[model samples]
Target: MMCETSDGDPGTDGGAAEAGADTGGDDVDEAGLAQFSALLEDSTEDLYDNAPCGYLSTLMDGRIAKVNSTLLDWLGYTGTQLVGRKRFSDLLTVGGKLYHETHFAPLLAMQGQVSGIALELKCADGSRLPVLVTSVVKTGSDGQPLLVRTTLFEAGDRRAYESELLRARKEAERARADAEAARKTAETERARLHQVVVILQKSLLPPELPQVPGLQAAAYYHPASTDQLGGDFYDLFALGDGSWSFFLGDVCGKGPEAASVTSLIRYTLRAACLHADGPAEALDMLNTALYARYTGNDPRYCTVVAGTLTPRDGTFDITVASGGHPPALLLRADGTTDFVRTPGGMLVGITSRPDFITSTTTLAPGDTLLLYTDGLTEARTTAGPRYSEEALHAFAHSLAPAGARQTVTALTGLLEGFGNGLDDDTALLALGVPAADGVGVT
Candidate 1:
């Protein structure tokens, strides 16, 4: 049975209940939205006061208008203490104030904004706080500037990092300067030591060859390095018996140790000449002295060509004794050359009874005898084989009919041509008998 109520239908009460449910849902939604809007409104002021960074506003005349709690806390100031009483520059330290007035203000005026300026603010407690500041101008409706809005970020860590980089740069520069100073000092010391070596080396050799009567004598010495003391040496001095004694030799090594051996050899040879019978005896005495003096692990030895010159009526008698030295060259007037070789001689100073062979030759009119250290024969000619003894013999043959001075001069030019290839010290001694016309003929 369909029953009609006062609204005339039986489902009228159910429809009224559903409509009430819809009204309740709408009211709940409105209430939630209202609550959310209220919360957002409440957070606006809180967000400004307790923001992560500092914020402030200043009047166009630079006077502080308002400052957030964050800024006040960082600067140790109160709202009442700073607002309307102090300018923005008053919060800055001395240098910051200068920069703000001279640079920041003018730039902001021209561009209407400034950003990322590093500055220091003086706190109320006298400590300075580093900050990176950014600022912009707030304008009115007519585009006229009203106030300045500025933001400050803490810059302590960044400032410290920059300071460390600067310190490191300065330290590197100091280290480089110290290194340059040390290098210069070392160079100066090397120069001084080279000078001393030069003086000491000169002392080891004869100042000049003594004058030989009736015979022309010439010599040359070249050291491979300016600083090293060369072991090659030569000398011509008059003996007490009217004959002259001359020697050309090379010690085992270089430097002061070899120089000491060379000094001993020179003095021993000169002293032995007074009592020794001949050139061979003089070398024997030298061998005995060397063997006795250096019999240890550091044995010293030398190769020598020692000889006596006895003047004849128109020539000189040459008696040369060799102790493992290269044979002397005899350049004759007839454009011929011969080696006065002593094949069986041993090196001096190594044996108690060393063998020394003697070779006799005469320096007749327009003839020359050339004596040299092995540095000459061992030199390189053109980056190929060594300048062998055979080549030198041929070379001397080409310079035959040459006198002492001319041959020596030509050989000097040859040695110079070797340049850096002559790695050893060289010594040359030439003895010649002049032609009857009295000029040294080349």
Candidate 2:
């Protein structure tokens, strides 16, 4: 398609000659052709120099023939520094140069054109400019290689955004790892505390049960939680005389404070008994000592039964003094079970000489005495029914003729059967009668 002036002038020698037919016709034709060629050259040069993106021409060997103003300003270089003297590869970073040789150049040669490649161009000031470049081979009519034309685009903002994103991701991962490590550390510390609670809890009980001559004694203690240090305690110790003192009691609460009072009661019992004569005298001493030790606004008291089982030839003399404790159960060889009821006693450590009632009983052959904390008779039932004293007595009756070891095992099993319902601590001490002529457990 040809575009000419509507008047039919086409920057042609014919039009000029027609007009010049009246004047300098030969000279006008020559001048018009020269001006037209010069204008064509100038317009082509200006389009190449001022293109929006980069424009370059490289020989098949990658030498730069021409470059545009946009890319020249982008690299902070002039045409003198780039054209003819420098190859396109000279503008690439060290890594970019290596990549061009290993993959880019080979790929371009095989595929004839490579477009929109990410690269870094080095400036004369020793700084780098990130860019996306494209190149193509200007093949001739027969498809022979001629020159390489390339375009370049700036990429500073994209690089900055990606760098920030990577930084944020790394920070998030670090925080997640730190949180996991903290969780594991806390769990480890809790386990250690549980272990300490277990040790401290065991410390509240006797190291070993006392050996009663001519009698077989066994005791069981079950803590509700390894995490909680219990207030329940039991002690089996020999008195100054030929008698032995035993007690099983529970504080009003559980945990560290109750544990402290439990320890006090144990030590006080031993000390008070050492300073006294019989079970009744021991209770009197304990009452006085405890009231003097811990009777205040915030009271610390316990339910206890201090008793003695003294061996008298072919029999055992038993004396029990109660301080708000449950009655003791006596299982006989005749399969008769009875409760030695002791009422009207107050909790120890509350008042001075709390009227601790004293009672007496005789232990003959095949008779078993059981002393326990309320954790037994007060155990919660699955039906939410309370385990009454009568129910415990009935259970003992069913378990008649059971020796000390068997009775303690059965009681511990019962305590466990309460499961999560057994919120309190339980301690039981069973002393079997004389062990059937000292043969063994019956």
Give one digit per residue, the lDDT tens place, for model 1 in 1-442.
0111142332344554454476674565665645544554434456667888888889999999878889899989999999999999999999999999999999999999999999999999999999999989888999999989998998989999999999999999999999999999988998997899888878878888777877888999888887788888888888888899999899999989999999999889888876788889999999999999999898999999999999988889989899999999999988899999988988999899888888898989988999999999999878677898999999999888789999999899999999888989999999998878654654
* 1-442 per-residue lDDT for model 2 (tens digits): 0011133324456654455675564666677756654554434456556766677788999889878787888778899988889998988999999989998899889998787788888988899988877777778899899887787778888778878999999999999999999999999998998999988888888878867777788988887777788888878888757878888788888788888888888888778777776666776676676677676666778888888878898678888888889999998777789998787977887787567778889888778889988877777899898788899899889887677877888888888889987777788988877545442274
| Candidate 1 wrong stretches, greater than 4 Å | 1-55, 66-83, 111-117, 132-143, 151-154, 332-337, 379-387, 390-403, 409-422, 434-442
TM-score of candidate 1 against the unseen true structure: 0.78
TM-score per model over all chains: 0.78, 0.67
Error of 1 at 146 (Å): 3.2
Q: Which ten residues in a row have the lowest lDDT in candidate 1?
A: 1-10
- lDDT computed for candidate 1: 0.87
